[model samples]
Target: MNNVKNLNKWANAHTYLSLDLVRIALGVFLFMKGISFITNIQYLQDLISPIDKIGGGMFLIHYIAPAHMVGGIMIAFGLLTRWAIIAQLPILIGAIIVNFMGEMHSQNLLLAILILGICVFFLFYGSGKHSADYYFKMQQ
Candidate 1:
């Protein structure tokens, strides 16, 4: 669509190294969280236990870890970066909700909020000039 193309043009024109670094850091953080979830799945289950009572929590248990791992990699490399961030959106929103519905750990709440903010920013910002997306676009 013309709107999407124009948005991409605006985002690309406003690229910054600092923003790229932030994107990379956010990706690494998500990846690390995924790794942690895999290593200690019980923790993930416990976090989602409230949602389990409402149904389909078991499905999320299987979905979140792998999504984070793969999505994080794509985000880090700026390969389909927006799609990767979009995949992360649901998980992050659920994380924030879970924090409120349950015991509400300050650390978890803060981290989720920060990551969500960064993801939202990237949703609009796209990958910068230093990303795989830009490189591929240039190749075409």
Candidate 2:
């Protein structure tokens, strides 16, 4: 009986209720910031200074923003945990390299670091059973 209980616990270990709050918050924040890029264009343009125009920024706003927002919402809902984490990974990496490591002001670097750290957390822990990954894997 004990063995069976342990197995159940292990299988259920990844549930959303068991997931980390930090990861959730990260997704929410990233989603909002991404949306802000399009919604508040002037603010974002001001932030991404030194580039005559961030071609990359346009890429992110158009291609990556929607993905990040969708992934983030899924992550927040514990829907598609692994996919969300994986999708957000490139955004974080580029963020760290572009804004923080670049010639931008200190605030930009700090924001990049904050976002990067949360993305890294999700990359590692996942949404657990609370995520769609749990059910999908079982079907497999």
The numbered model that scores best in TM-score is 1
Q: For residues 1-140, what per-residue lDDT tens digits would candidate 1 score against the true structure?
A: 68767878998888888999999988888899999999999999999987788899878988999999999889899999999999999999999999989898999999899999999999988887889998999999
Scored against the true structure, residue 57 in model 2 reaches a CA lDDT of 61
Q: In candidate 2, what are the lDDT values of residues 1-140, reduced to their tens digit?
A: 57644544664664455344655776687688778766877765555443425466665556556777887788777676666777877766665565644465667668767766766665555555654655676789
C-alpha TM-score for every candidate = 0.96, 0.66
| Per-model CA lDDT versus the true structure | 0.91, 0.64
Q: Locate the minimum summed-lDDT window of 10 residues in model 1.
A: 1-10
Which candidate's lDDT is highest?
A: 1
Clash pairs detected, candidate 1: none
